[model samples]
Target: MPTLSAADVRAALLAGAEIALIDVREEDPYAHGHPLWATNFPLSKLELEAWTRIPRRNTTIAIYGEALGEDLAPRAAAVLAALGYTRVHRLEGGLAGWQAAGGECFIDVNVPSKAFGELVDATRRTPSLSAQEVKQLIDTRADIVIVDARRFDEYRTMSIPTATSVPGAELVLRVRELAPDPATRVIVNCAGRTRSIIGTQSLINAGLPNPVAALRNGTIGWTLAGQTLDHGASRRFPEHVDAERREAARQAARGLARRAGVARIALHDLRTLESDDRTLYRFDVRTPDEYAAGHLPGFASAPGGQLVQETDHHAPVRGARIVLADDDGVRADMSASWLAQMGWDVSVVEPVDARERGERGQPAARAPQPAESPTVSVATLAEWLGVKAAEGDAANGLAEGHASRAGAGARDTRDTRDTRDTQDARAREVAREDVDENAAQRADEARREPLAERSARSDDASADVAVIDVTASANYVQRHIPGAWYAVRAQLRDALTRIPRARRYVLTCGSGQLAAFAAADLRGLVPDGASVYVLDGGTLAWLAAGLPVEDGETRLASPRIDRYRRPYEGTGNAAEAMQAYLDWEFGLVEQLRLDGTHRFEVL
Candidate 1:
């Protein structure tokens, strides 16, 4: 593969040339440090996600990773090449090389969004309330309403004592109804800080008469102050706002977006930019459920809160133009304003008719299609693993292909079966238990017991089928098949050497998409007589089938570099790590100024 020096990547970014500065490492290590514009497209997921994320196959691509001298970077370049990416090149010395060349390395994820929040706080002097002060108000039953600015599921996981989930952009549309009286105090919070600051500032920008403030440092500050959080809380802002309030909020939000240099274009005007060579992303900024019911022809569903939190994910190209659509007007404007301040050429489509919202659910990506691989249903795989049904699960087999099939007989939380919320929740549960020694030990013991003793079929039933899980290491350690081995997709040939050879091999991952590609690759690695098949729908399907899952690191086949525990997430973080995270966030604004690539202009 050809190489690009760190200086070359820097020059390309500065010149505003179309280039993808990619980090091929998993998200965990990628979050620890990376270049400002480097989007993470892990080697483990190259075949599954690269096409949708990078968009143009022939675009300039500079790839880097911690495993610079190893087969990792070269292997990644080869994968991209196989996908028809013609200009893929390795970063001369990787991240350290970038640092040596005076490229600043930012620690933590979402640097662009969080740094912009700090700039907003500094310039707007966004008002805030300490944890103690907020706690006092809650104790006194004062005329105050606390609203969480995170997603509804995140709010449900942990939130203030009595906070309602309004999410970020919903603050303007819903806060008026939430606190009708001008004297009613409103406080906003998120897991950490950015969303709260943006949410609180959103209300202020909309010119709400009510006194507005952010819960300082959000829930992190609350916990550090020795306060408690309410788990599984379901309080939510009213979905239906009074018509008069909605119209008022729309005008207020529009004015704020206009002040921030966000353009307002009619829905029809969106066509003019479609033919431009520049990347243009059209997203419906309404809530997921709202977008699912109806949305623009080619637009994808990206709730406003998540869109702001993950701009690099939604639009990886830094110079890409973004167009947002929301029927209510409040969400698109509030979301677009923040994107504009963060140096995005964002616009909102006006007068979007009900007719335009003809397409439903999420839009499909125009990814390259590899030859489809053979698959075995989750129940069939379970049966092959010598796990007999418990008398009542005779009809538990799900049909083959995609999410809906896997979700059909979902054992628990079926409503959220296909959403990222369910997947994140499952991953968190696995991570949390893996860290708990008592829980991990108990799970290990349970899995160690024989699978043959209670099996209706002979032990030979499982002897010939070797199951390999290609999901993240954290998820693999927490939940997997009784005898399945865990391995990174990139190192399949190496991993297969370590595992006992079987006549037939089965591969699985989070949703089976990655496994499908890995299975195809595995077919080439194994002997001619050996059979390779993907577990239909992957691990999620296995979970939905309510089949037995063995937790703990039973069949260790790979290193655990796939997931990095964020200091801000969950409740078991050490005091030092949490405090250090807050301190790192505090210094971001200074770093943004020093970097000089960010074109942020606070409104």
Candidate 2:
């Protein structure tokens, strides 16, 4: 019930005050701007149902929002207090206070970069690489991997020949898949400074393998350095998508729309659908961040990944026709392909091409048009979709346990009985549709993760476990589980500074998935008697479990012990050492031959 000023919160954060910063605002408002460290848990959802997202009950939580004056903040505090969570406090002046204090806010479709930036600043190390140096290295065909840390569309526009497209948010999830070999030097970049700077920092902060650094100044710097840009289109896509391919993908989407039973409404049909009695499931398959930034009036977000991951969760209108909106045909077309493959009743809502029908008032066609069916009765279709939605809800644990149990037999036994009673006569004709590559991509990512990582988890880990904090110096210093030792997976050898590998280690991360991977990788690297285990659900889960956490960047003791900086044991390559540092800084060391320089093959 007490309130803390912005300065108070800032001081706590800066001094390593372990606390959960909660932004109690609407999703849209939270998306626009929230404190750098805050995680959104809208008060509206808490009004309807308790939130399961926040990490812990006993955590020292600081809640803030512009709407705090509108009773939302107090109510949120009450909910937490009633839930037996002690130490829930409100921000004295809400976001206004934080912003007034010169604090920063962040916005992104996925993992907000502002939070990642804060982590980077905490370590006193900047993620950077010389543009000229990386280009020169690439010219030699050395063992270097360049990654374009921008959206796919951005990559399509322009990128280095050696770079591959990997969006900033997806970097943590997909980095290992792209570069499995630890010896390969990794370089990340974006169009300008912020993303490239922050993206590289995130991976480093997360303790990923491969000596990683950001291409300073990104594509602009590379271009200034006079490097050639490859449009990446020739990297794959066929030169021309023939009529046959387009028709097949279109038909596939149509068939899916038909089977799903969503009315294949055209863009101009919005008025009619709004007036109809039946419920509608309108979707926009663009990025969630884009949707949050701005979207069509009637549509809800069904970003490609979430749509495929939870089709039944979003669209329950089995056999009902669906309406979709996309900026260009690419995303919609890509999504349509997947829905078509899944047997949804779908159709492309083509825009009225202004060129074909002049703007002011176009004349009607001379030929008589066939009258469409008067609202094809979808009452039965609606019911079928509802049943499917209900089933999906149960599968995802969104439904009540009691309701799920009761619906179990109803699905199987009743489905069989209903099938015997109905069937062939009711079979709806599904128009062929095209497949959405986005959907396929989503499906591929969804299918990639094993079941063990996807299931609901608990935080009651074993006691006195050796928890290795597998995060960069910045992330470790920002906030982490108390007593967890830090290890930079990028600098594994250097990580062996203060901590010995002889102890039993439980790797901990923001999410347990990456930590699990690290644990597996470290299995053979540690001493013979030492053992490693993953902290189930990582540090986030640990926080949610009401466990203790502390702040301050985990860093190697100052006065960096330069044990390996002595004269090169195998090859006296002082020139190589100086050259490697210069190339790393300026971006063209490989071209300058290492004459009488240190040469140590990392492999």
Q: How many residue pairs clash in model 2?
A: 48
- For model 2, residues 459-546, the per-residue Cα lDDT tens digits are 4232223456654333456455544677644233345456643455666555443354455456657677766666554555443332
lDDT of each: 0.78, 0.47
Provide the TM-score for each candidate, comma-separated. Answer: 0.87, 0.31
Worst 10 residues of 1 by lDDT: 393-402
Model 2 poorest ten-residue lDDT run: 424-433
**What is the RMSD of candidate 2?**
29.9
- What is the overall TM-score of model 1 with all chains considered together? 0.87
lDDT of 1 by residue, 1-603 (tens): 799998887777776666788888877778889877887777877776776666666777898885523646787898899898888999998888888888888987777888888889989999999999999999999999999988887787788999999978788999989899999999999988899988998899899999999999988898999999999887888988999999999999989999989898887788887643567788888877888898888787778887898787777777778899999778999999989988788889885669888988656545455568888998788778876332222222211111232232121111111244444564445445434555444433443333544454544678788999887676677567778999877677778887888888999876676677787779989877999998887777775654556668888777676666777666677878888988998998899877878778888
Clash numbers, per candidate? 0, 48
Best by lDDT: 1
